[model samples]
Target: MAVTGGRAPNQTDSDGRSELGKALRACRGAFIGVGIMSFMINLLYLNGSLFMLEVYDRVLPSRSVPTLVGLVVLAGGLYVAQGLLELIRSRILVRVGTSLDEALGGRIFESVIRLPLIAGGGGDGLQPLRDLDSVRSFLSGMGPSALFDLPWLPLYLAICFAFHTLLGLAALIGAVILIVITVLTEVLARNPLHEAMGLTVRRNALAAASRRNAEVVVAMGMTGHHTRHWSAVNDDYLAQSRRSSDLIGGLGTAAKVARMMLQSAMLGIGAYLVIHQEATGGIIIAGSILSARALAPVDLAIAHWKSFTAARQSWQRLNKLLMILPRQREVIQLQAPSRQVLVETISLVPPGSQRVVVAEMTFALEAGHGLGIVGPSGSGKSSLARALVGVWQPVRGKVRLDGAALDQWQPDSLGRHIGYLPQDVELFAGSIGQNICRFDPEADSQDIIAAAREAGVHELIVAMANGYDTQIGEGGHILSAGQAQRIALARALYGQPFLIVLDEPNSNLDAEGDEALTRAIRSARERGAVVVVIAHRPVAIEGVDLLLVMKDGRAQTFGPKETILGQILRPPPGPIKIAADGGVAKP
Candidate 1:
């Protein structure tokens, strides 16, 4: 059997696009637009240097007011155009980031929800959202602009060469030095940044877990212990962040200093050329400007080195995760389940283990029948219930409903026909009516009331302050355990599902609640829905027509309820005995 539910490694879609490629493709047009705008923006950068050259070479030499005024007008026009292009480029990038988030956010959440059911699917659940945010932040920020402008460095260098060969040589050498600094920044910060990101994810997950279980922690007096544990994790994250920041900050400082010195050195070289009568004063200042422009992209890259590494790592991690998730298949229309469940020697193992939880168990239940599965703790009753409801796929044999395999049916379609109440009932934050209606946007009010009445919670709900409109706090914490379980039962019974599996449905029920549960089961059976209840108490199983006794992951007995109960409760044969005092004796 497969160890986990993960897809094969390196899986791809029909068009052969990897998950990373698919995400990037969504922003391709914006990236290209940014590239074009960068080219225009860099070309306009020459307006300032050229204007300086014109002021020194022509306007000042001729002392002509008209010429200077014309140059000023031209420079203003170029600056205006450059600003407009920059604004457009920024807007496009922002749109690209938003679009990417919109495209992938829902898919990532769905993948997270499905991950636990798949084999080999183990990772921080919230990491994908963070990774997506990382990608979006980088794309919309100044980092991408630096990359877009990097290619123009060569053009700037060529301008310096046009002024004088020695000035060109100085600019080229400075560019090489700054490039080395950028590389060093990456090498030094990569590990520290990666470590810091991991710690942040762990810390966030820990904090969320602690908050979710706050009541228990406070009651158990574990608040101090958890606080100290979280503090240690935070300290580790801070240390790694400090290391990364220190390295990037050092490189940024060095790059800035080197760029300033390089400009000065180019000026010095230009001045020497002018002294030799090989270049003019106008060319000297323009050469220095060009040299600064040439190294600006490299400087920006080094300054934003941390964001680059984080984004790169996030991209890789997201790619690996998305690839491992199974590709969504085309939905096939199938008929609804007809309450005929055939469990043909089905076996179930835990998600990440080979140890069987339900072993080679075979049974069949027809419409209008109720099966009560009674077993000791750890006897696999819950596992069998999960298999029956398609939460856990069988490792061997098959579970067929209406002559079709459970896994073969479309999930949403199948879900509409299956009502499952796990041992631990968890209700989401919503109104009582909304939870009962399964949060369906188009849920009919009549059906909601019918389901509540059938589950025997309608009277209790109408007695509340807002009737069906009462708001339940997160996980239904505001309600008593019995209330939550009854509401959960109402949710399961909604839409009159053809098959219902209730695992320990009455675990938290009082006497009234127990009667309500039994009435619900009988009502469902009357509607010809096959009902399966896993129970520990005899009262909970009293209405069941069939009994299945499980022990040690195997079904010990499966037959009529009276026959099985009689056989189990029958007294063992023994030899008759007499009391030593001659009184009647019991054996």
Candidate 2:
């Protein structure tokens, strides 16, 4: 939100020690090296131009026309080469950025995945990470490019000073005055500009979130509501953009004034020198051209900086994601779990929610037991599944894995015992084989096919024209909801785990798909891995050992399904049907 003139004052060196820092440091070096080469090219170009000017004045009348044409061509070649080099330097920036992207991007993902745990769990992440991404992209794209232009001005002034101290003094004064005006205008517009940028980032995040959840908006017939929200936010951003534009225009005016002053200073000083027989018109003309050519990139940088400022905010946001502590660490241990997971007094709070969604929950699942989690929507069935796998840490209690706290179980160790399928099905835009072997890259094709058959997705995969090799579009657009879910189940099955946490595995499944999933769950149980399924419908959880009803953030009852269904979940489908710790049920 500091886009409204707020900035992280102490962030300079704190986040600067990561791979991003190393990449940016390398970028800084590239920028300096490019600037030096650019300066040399510019110097060569000027020398050639000046030579041509001198040739025209002193030798054109007496020289052969062909020789003069050759001189002109050579000078044009220098200018052409200079132009090409500038273009090349800018182009190389894209590659340099790509290289850095590959090396450091995972760290950004890690940061986002980790920081929420540090901030008291998932409730403080989603929005901040979105904002961070915006800032990081803008900054990384073009913010530091100003450095490329910053160097040439001083060097140009020094060159002018070398020829004549008096002329150099005037040039220096003129440049100083220009810089002062630039700084003054920037300061004057600082508050409004920053506020406008903050609003812009906010609006952008809203638009992005809206776009992501567009299906829900459309389904609820809340299109008008969101349209109005987006329009108002967009208008605010537009207004701020106009204000920034106006400030730039005003700065342009100031630059115009500075240029006029420069022109007058050069001419008047040159006239004074000529009258006293101390200087010539040629010197003045050369000085003016050199100065103008030298400041071209500065002028260009000024324009680019206006664009770069917006991008700087974006880069900052993106970099923030890289700073979040990942929910899952990269640590791995070959040692396996010593005991099954035990939960006591656990709670779940989603990012950005004010109330705790699930609270003070306790449970112990003996190895090989299938626990059924039944609840109404918002009763925290999905949250329980995530917490068991340590996706979101419990707010009030510890989840012990293998007789140790979940964190003590090495990062990869939990994965070996734990496989989770969230309520919504997600698939990569790749083949079935790729999705199945995501965790085990070295998994054999036969093993992948076996897991697929176990999940009841092998037949579907065979139906596709490319079979297992067929590409699944984004989120498996080409496949049905049931197919994607089964594929996800297959992926979890591909890697052997001691525990399986499935959130609403039967959610979008047809009667046949549900039966298939139930069979798969039976297989996991037979294999001696504990299975926890977030159940919605009253399907026969025949293979499950015990069922727990979750209501009002606590375990309403712990007993057989027959005991809780009549008491907890089988209540009338109206008025939330309260069954928390024996409250009077609502109809």
Candidate 3:
């Protein structure tokens, strides 16, 4: 099954287990080929013991130089073939890993972008990529090889038994001991390893947060405090990691010692059989080699147990995240919006809070109209703006555009006709033109220039060292705050969006910038666009035709701009009286 941006229409699995299963299934042929090569490699492995047996039993007794030369050549050829097969198997595994990464990386990234900002509290948004890397590393590493070689253990043990029953019994007992050691490693390391993983995730998040706020850290002389805080988290991570390592290390050492003892014991048993004339010296050598081969995979597994467990945990977490945030399916293509926005009794509560941030907001704007939202600092102006543009879903009621729910339209399709400038403006690292054009590969130069002109930033952009091609550093740090805000405004105005929502767009603008913004709003309205502006200062909303007054999460008044402004600035008829219940009363 092909992985896409959204959940597949026919996908019925709730947990997304089937998606992972499908990725593995795509690589089934490669794995099967690797399995076959492993079989050949194991068969060739026995040639060493067989060569020793023949040399001691036949060549030595016969003293035929030609026979010895012939046996050496045959064994040499088999060894070369085994090495070639091993190389091919490794290559196949590497291809499988890359292919799996290619298939899921894009899909996971798309899902991460679509995730609601509130839902992604304290997450760096790159965790999914890291999880994908963990899975790929496991697939191409020594862990899977050890697992593949495990099934051949019985075959090696059967060969040991063929040599002599006592040798076979010794090998079996040694294998059992190693298996027990493996179990012990898991039981002892499980909790500590789990704790270490959680600590690592938190540490990464802290580091990312600190980096993003480096300016504040330096300005407030918080560098020392941040360092100490990070160090504490790092120390905890190290402690748990050390605990896990100590247990695994002790068990690994024990397994090594036991394997060595098993080899010695096999030699002793072989010597005893030879003395009784029950077996030849050749069988003694062959039995020791076969017994060691039988236990090799078990030892390797014990050595790499930590990585195996980490990969398993990462897989489970990734699956759960994908299940919870499945991709959206393709929707029927709809025409561009016609600048009609309807918000019906929409209320919004923050992701983890019970208090309503936006309460029962009901409004409508037709083509060629502008609405200004004025409110106090905590009166939910920003929240209402976010809901209008579909950033935050309303807990109750709906936001409709062109007679359809906002969410009913595919996100990309809906986004094309909706322009939004958030309270905090940010620009990615790229050329100025790219940022203004929304990073569209097929963006038209004429349209980009038009947008910059519309936002009154075209002259500022052209004055830069490279004009429209000037490269903005990370988060547009190369430009001033005002410059960045203007560029973001230009981005929102690009493509002549049918509906535009600006949340405190002029927060960083100077007097001249303010004039440019007013002109831009007027121009949009002239072009039949429905514009919504959230502002604190009255001057910023001078050109708006309608006004919405918000206070304490409720609409205080809504009407033409002149009527609401008059009411707000006008005094009450008589002295306001205080009621017994501490409420204001008009008599």
Q: Candidate 2, TM-score vs. the true structure?
A: 0.79
Per-residue lDDT tens digits of candidate 3, residues 1-587?
Answer: 22224556214366544566678778999999989988998999999999999998899999999999999999999999999998888888888988988988887787567554546365556777788888899888888888889899999989888888999999999999999999999988888999998899889989999998999999999999999999999999999999899889999999999999999999999999999998998888888888888899999999999989988887777776666666677667677788579999999997656789888889889998899999889999998998888878898999998888887877777788989999999899999999999999999999999999999999999998899999998899999989999999999999999999999989999998899999999999999999999999777897789999999888999999999889989987888999999999768
Return the candidate ranking by TM-score, descending.
3, 1, 2
Model 3 alpha-carbon miss at residue 262, Å: 1.4
- Give me the runs in candidate 3 sitting further than 4 Å from their true place: 1-6, 9-17, 116-118, 574-587
- Global lDDT of model 3: 0.88
lDDT of 2 by residue, 215-268 (tens): 999999988999899899889888987887788777767666676667677667
lDDT score of residue 12 within candidate 2: 37
Candidate 2 error regions (>4 Å): 1-19, 27-32, 42-88, 91-94, 109-146, 158-166, 188-193, 206-221, 326-332, 409-413, 439-441, 559-587
Comparing 2 with 3 on TM-score, the higher-scoring candidate is: 3
Q: Per-residue alpha-carbon lDDT of model 1 for 301-361, expressed as tens digits?
A: 8888888899899888877777766545545556777758899998889787889888989
